[model samples]
Target: MAKASVNSPSGPASVETLTTRGRKTRDALLDAARTVFEDVGFPEARVELITAAAQVSYGTFYRYFESKEDVFRVLSDQLFEDIHHRGPSDSTLSPAQRLIAANRTYYQAYRRNARLMAIVEQVATFNDDFRRLRHDHRHQLIDRQARAIARWQQEGLVRQSLDPEMAARAMSAMVDHTLYLWLVQGDEANEALLLDTLDQMCLGALGLDQD
Candidate 1:
């Protein structure tokens, strides 16, 4: 037998190729995990199922992540990042206008990703990692809304009795409940109807005459 050359590109090429393949394999595993989580939910979902679905080996899974929850955290962060991809903007518009813009953006997003949103909410209810993310995001959103409410208060547009923090949380709750009802009821409440109803509710809460 001819002496094998240790310095040949063939030997090095095999290692380089495997390294590249490993990255592709990791991405595929994450993608498969997201799909499985969406279908079966986080609590009921299993790593073996995700790896099997991706056709990746158990050892490969360990090389990428410590546990299924690690993958879940990545997915949760990506989901929020996608939701905020539009970017948040501060407005010089009136308080009510700001409210409408914010509410409309949320409504549009919910309509586009109702299933994903529902799954995220369900998962957050049970998963501590997801729950922390959910709470953190909600706090950020409410803080932004509270600042908007404060602006209106400074302008004397809204009643002084209106508490910005409380108002923001109330508005968030209203939007959440409305979305839940719409999702569970199958179009029983249309967007236009929801907008009108929310407008009325918000105006009443803010002590503003409908304009």
Candidate 2:
């Protein structure tokens, strides 16, 4: 009941039309790609495997993704967007309370997506584009954290001498490294203790809770 067309050949006529079935088939390929990538890791995953998993013809994949990496790039973009959970929404929550909520949400999201996250790290190791992608993602967060710190400094919540960029990067590292170890690296540790420690460290770094 839907319309679709072949985009691989680069024809406007094809791009302008696709059937519902065509859309379904395209989605199947993407879904299958995710499964295959997660199972074998991106480096070893084959397009044939993805096609087989999707129950689609080999030619059908080409109609959509130009290559394995193309499909992977699409999947990676989606996953990275979801990697960080939203910040606090409760306007009444104290800054410390908001930090705790944000940290908790981040930890939970990371745990759920650990497998894909691990693959992202592996892919970034040798792939220049993915490496840059990872760096840019971090850089963005650093900027946000720096802005937040600057605001806190103005409110006299944190020391004025604290460098916003430096502090943000440091605290961001603290949370990222800790979770990467516990979730991605499968380090053995008490989950509650780990999260508690993260909360304490972040709060102290922000000069929220101190002696």
Candidate 3:
């Protein structure tokens, strides 16, 4: 979406340029914004509510953020960072085991940020900027997985007939959509069973020999 124009001569201060105290205040506003967005969503959320939740004033809010959409973008960036984190990889694990571990880690991250993700999903429906942001992040993830699948295929781990990028995209959709259904849509699910099923489905799609 088009950014709301700020009246300031210098515009919103970059996070790097903020003083220690300024960073604290900005962080407070971000924390408050996340809560407000999760509780009331983007359309209903107002700067006043965020400032009130942060125990700050309108001047303080404007000092850190250009507008509500700006703060939401910051929060969305953070959420994506956390979701994108893969942590340390264990080289000793088999490809199949690593895939399961990756799925588990992703699922856990999704569950932790499920509330904010729901809000992001809602915002993306009509907001072009957010829609592109969401799509770009997903594409990055798929690209990484496709590369891994291609490597595994060369190593004779995954089936030669499968297209790496297509398999990655399809598997990603399965996991992502399933989590949205269970977490965002509040579909009842048993965690262990669901994750195991997802792991199995991904492995099966790659035609990997789990033996």
Candidate 4:
């Protein structure tokens, strides 16, 4: 059976004709690739390192992935999925509560995947496709948040004067950059204080503090 297709530098590539055992092997290679990338970064990472880490032959690596970059794309896709968060769906909760819950979820996910995130950050600096992928993912989050803010504004839960998209972008940057510093850059922080302050800042920016 065909596995999910991922974009390569040349074009889209599919992992064609995989059995149950083949799927396990492919997953092993991906896990090893993630470890290697996190340990040595994208530029230093090699197929041999991944194969060695996976305990698979170098030839086996090519069966699942076309190249190092190909496997990295798959890893990046997984990282994106891991980090993607949507706000709480409980309609009974107040807007402020939902926002706080969403922020908490995002922070927790970032903490769990900080190493991979750092690798992706480094790769995005030099790789055009990775850079675009990173931006697109961030923008998707921002757009969703913007729509939420607009809805809150319509409900009179947010300040009418604030532009939803701009506010969303600024608030998203505040949360994302702060997490990068604390988690990826190893900045010292009190976890409770950091999260609480982030919640307050997000609320205050939207005028939800009044509620």
Q: Which candidate leads in TM-score?
A: 3
lDDT of 2 by residue, 87-135 (tens): 5389888777877887788788788778888888899898888888788
RMSD for each model, in Å, please? 9.3, 5.0, 1.1, 4.4
lDDT of 4 by residue, 92-187 (tens): 778898888888888888988999999999989988888998999889888989999999899988999999999999999999999999999989
Candidate ranking under TM-score, highest first, comes to: 3, 4, 2, 1
The residue-level lDDT of candidate 4 at 152 comes to 88
Question: Which pairs clash inside model 1?
Answer: none
Clashes of each: 0, 7, 1, 0
Whole-model lDDT values for every prediction: 0.72, 0.80, 0.92, 0.86
68-151, model 1: which lDDT tens digit per residue? Answer: 777777677766665544446665665566566666777777666566677778878766767888889788878877887788
Candidate ordering by lDDT (highest first): 3, 4, 2, 1
What ranges in model 1 sit over 4 Å off? 1-27, 84-92, 184-187, 207-211
Candidate 1's displacement at residue 96, Å, is 2.3
The local distance difference test score of model 1 is 0.72
lDDT of 3 by residue, 1-211 (tens): 5566665778888988999999999999999999999999999999999999999987788888989999998899889889978989999989998898888889999999999999999999999999999999899999999999999999999899999999999999999999999999999999889888999999999988675
Give the residue spans of candidate 4 off by over 4 A: 1-17
Error of 3 at 103 (Å): 0.6
> Once all C-alphas are superposed, what RMSD does model 2 give against the true structure?
5.0
Which candidate wins on lDDT?
Answer: 3
lDDT of 2 at 115: 82
Stronger candidate by TM-score (1 vs 3): 3
